[model samples]
Target: MTDNLGRGASWQAQSSQSWLTVTASGVAGGPMQIQADPSALATNTIHYATVSVKSSDSGVSAAQPVVVALWKGTESVREVATTAAVASRYTRLLADPVRPYAYAHSNSGMVADPVRPHVQLYSNSGTIDVYNIYTGALVKSMSAPGSTLGKMLASPDGAYLYAHDLAGRQLKVFDLREGQVVATWPLDASLSVFEGGLIDLIYARPNGVGVLVVSTGQVFRASDGKLLATKIAQMPNTDRLVHGLQPFRGLSSSYLAASLDGMRVFSTDSRLYMVPNTPFYWDMDYTETNEGTLSVTKAYAANLGTTLDAGLSQAGGIAMSRDGSRVLMLSAVAGISLWSPADLSKDRMLAQDLGLQSDTLNVTPDGNIVVAGSTFGQGSPQFHVLSPDGRLLKTQVTRIAASTVKPGSTGTISALTADMAVSADGNVAIQSAIHDVDTNFGYLLTFAPIRP
Candidate 1:
């Protein structure tokens, strides 16, 4: 079941199964390679990726070679060999019940080999894997001290990239071109520090502000690598709120979207504050919780600030559009909340708001949306696209979230299963899951074009 994609062509992900082989025209799928489903195919009028998988293209059957198959439209393309996919003994001792960690790009782009479009991998294994966007082959692996790397971000110029080592007690910056360590900022700058659990993510401002938000609740300027705010991290996610923004185990990405493009952060606590480098420029204000209330405090936002646990309840799983105008949050109410730096007051709910079960969210390059909504207790989700007018694009039905029959669901719609992504053009989408395991664990679902 290999497929191919066109230039900037978007695909509407029909279903998410497991262990199936899929591909794009000339582009090949590989580990760390970006993908889009058949139904939501988006391309820039280029080559596609050819896919190669196991059987019936059904559910994923255990761990196999290569993560996905890349294709353009129809012809067989390439394969991201899973040969390098190693089995770790660490699971024997400290394994997570479900998916423990995942990756996120500060910007929206293809997940191909490092050669074609330049793909970067942020791992918990104390290193960043730079690969070929077309082949998923490792171009260079950047090493960090004795620490598992957290979220990562790259500069607009693609010159430098940064990550945090929770155990190494250091923030590492590597030269993307040189593929070597450029600078290491340790906690206290005197000695390395190790914190078992730390929350962190990177944001590259369109203006090149490149900022990194750490779990210790600190924000650092990714460009010059300057420490901006140390106290802003505490304002969001109060000690209270049972099952608030926190999720199962160490699995969720901190729900803070850096404002390097702006000047504030909407913390897990849900309060939007003015994060000025000066700090003392203005006093921070508090806000109300639950979904329908925002308390204003300054001349800027009358009642505008980020919401508490309502949007992204999961510890991790946070991302923003290329322009930073909208925030795609995951968990609970589980939908994308569209907000702008200009309007601090009202927040608009786009796509999957009307009776659609949502588990995660992602913004596409073309302003469309890719949402994963499943039924098998967040298992088999459908990928959907909502046009810029806030209306459902293409055919009649709703976006992909509820587009298909959810896994483990006999009824209309049950829950969302996995995550979603779009191409640089936002015309194509890739959706699938792991299936055929002890508990139907791995499944693959991709959305490609049926016709022009």
Candidate 2:
């Protein structure tokens, strides 16, 4: 990097390949160098590395690939070098979600710690797996004597994990760093008396400060699992905004989306609730009126009859933006729809033609961009980046071993498993994918948006 314009210029370099390392990370107004070592090759082969550069002034970044050829003690009879068009579509697999058990293993559990880079994944075998997203490595797994694990929640500071043991009727909090169970609280004995059994424990959530057990209607301090409140409906009244936590019965929502603070919540059931950040609570249930009509009612708010089309179903997912300004509804088979929280009016529809069929739609913490995974249909566009105004900005694909698609195929011949997470800045993303029959395993991928 150089400062030819006489103004201060700073540059940072990152290496995409393991064999390559940035000798000089942050070089300002001078020469920056990267080192590569590939002398231990047993056979002649070519290795590639991509070096990304970015200045401190702008979010835009650039990358260039460095190719090197290595050979064994014997001279190579043939040498082949390939050059592929390189955009900022840099995606790399971190690792398999669960390496030990890959056969018929689906990621049934996942939660990101609010304050740390730690991500907890639940496995089918009654184990809670934890991984550090920043390091791209599996830290550890926590399991108990029971096989029926309900829902898991992380503390705000990423120091603890609260998990519900439905079989044992207990809530356990683990210290993430030590990988040890710190506290355990027995569930309400009356819970087992419910007609639906103990499965209702699945609606548990851990606010940064305390854990809210929806099934049992109890709140526990996140630090020690101490009983904070017996019932969520009976919390001490305060003036601050209380985080609204409501578990709708009989609504089989496959996915649940909530604010980072764990306050506001919405599901595919078409119901949205906002809880006061303090101890107050408010919940609204969206009910089906007719074959194609829906209506919402509030117990406290009189004269409030809200209705909408019964288009929302299990095939789609709903999300409330971080800013609480917009609500996004998504279906991989369908397209995208945005609505206003104030009046439930349609705001903007990204249209199914754009291939917005992602497992979920996530808005950046700043609420600037809406990111979602894309499949083969609709021009085979990859993950899409949408501006606040709902304009397409960038389209990127995971860098994985993909099978060749027919000239015109309707299905997703090569598509991601629809699992992804975007950074708070909306500049980078980490996604999972399973590509090609040769490698029928899932891989974690990280990439940045290709600036136009």
Candidate 3:
């Protein structure tokens, strides 16, 4: 119960059912506690009761209805029975692609193609596939040169798909609508050294300037990928290179998210960087001594004027609303935090007492709603939707794993099965699982709006 009264106000809680008990006789401008006897609940039925509150200042009284829902074993809560609907479900992702590693951990494997009615998935075998998500029909497929694919990013206009080559030295641009290869750009020779793993991708076009953010840092480019500039590199201590941010490996590290306007980019490590710099390049020196190991000293680079540290120890996910007014950040210990893009200094922690670790976060295009996927094992899997001010509007438990249904069950659920995506309309949500290295498979779930 919340206290909304001004000045000093005393209130008492009363209930008609003996199963409900009030822990305190009265409360003044604070929370009122209530206890329930779970053993007294009737099986397979929803218990209802009315709680009345009386104010000491006046004779005004108010009563609210409460509900307690109980279920039997082997039965599940059906969304259709309530006000929600399940729009789509793909049971096994590994069987269809025929590539076990395709469903493996990817910073960005599945993304809604900027074009309407189509979604893209990577096979990591030099193949890019597009399908109609609503119908589950393959629309098109194109093959590049390498079986080891990096991040797959679509152009802002949905005309082309940009990805790193197998060697991780060059960038390949595939024309999605035209169905052909348009251009391939190569990086500096020093960067050609084989760095195995997924590379983060962020495609942003704010105002009229287009920029691409990858593992190496921000790259400024035109819509056609012709005019390019290396704004930031990995090792150099140049004016544009950012310092104090450590690069990590676990799929989620080194992630990037651009504002709706594309003027700024946010990293998974709780740092924001400005994009669109002048075309220039610089390299740092690395020497191999008799020990056969490379040695180099770090240098302090010039700090960019536009940078904000949100104070997250390790940010797992970051997202910005379509209007670029609000931001959502998710970390292991801090739960979820919301910040105002206009002034990030003014921020608030949302659902801190949830007692669940979140793996991913997404906000609606309009900046009105935010959703987060919880860690699988630490607690029951759930998706939390909240308003801009951190008010929780809904908590939808995604699933009950086999292990949880019956301890010591046959199959175990991966704690990394939590991934979320919100549609542009803000009415539909698609939740899926990504292989967490040890597991070789994943599943997908979709939710449509009946009413919010």
The candidate scoring highest on lDDT is 3
Candidate lDDT scores, in order, read 0.36, 0.42, 0.44
- Over 4 Å off, model 2: 1-107, 132-135, 148-152, 164-172, 184-311, 342-348, 355-359, 369-374, 377-381, 401-415, 439-452
Per-candidate clash tally: 124, 10, 1
> What lDDT is reached at residue 178 by model 3?
70
- Cα RMSD (Å) between model 1 and the true structure? 16.6
Error of 2 at 422 (Å): 2.8
Query: Compared with the true structure, what per-residue lDDT tens digits does model 2 show for residues 1-452?
Result: 53323355566677777777774455445667766576554442324445666667553233222222221224322111001111111121111211110001122334544434334555435565544443334556666545445555554334566665656667766676576777777877655323213222222232222334343444444435555445433222222221222222222223444433343333333122211101112232211234212112221111111222323322345566766676676755446666655445455566556655434466765555554555553443367777666777767654422222223313222334355544323434444443344243233323323344
- Candidate 1 lDDT at 236 equals 21
Q: Model 3 — TM-score against the truth?
A: 0.53
TM-score for each candidate, following the candidate numbering: 0.50, 0.51, 0.53
RMSD of 3: 19.2
Judging by TM-score, tell me the better candidate of 1 and 2: 2
Best by TM-score: 3
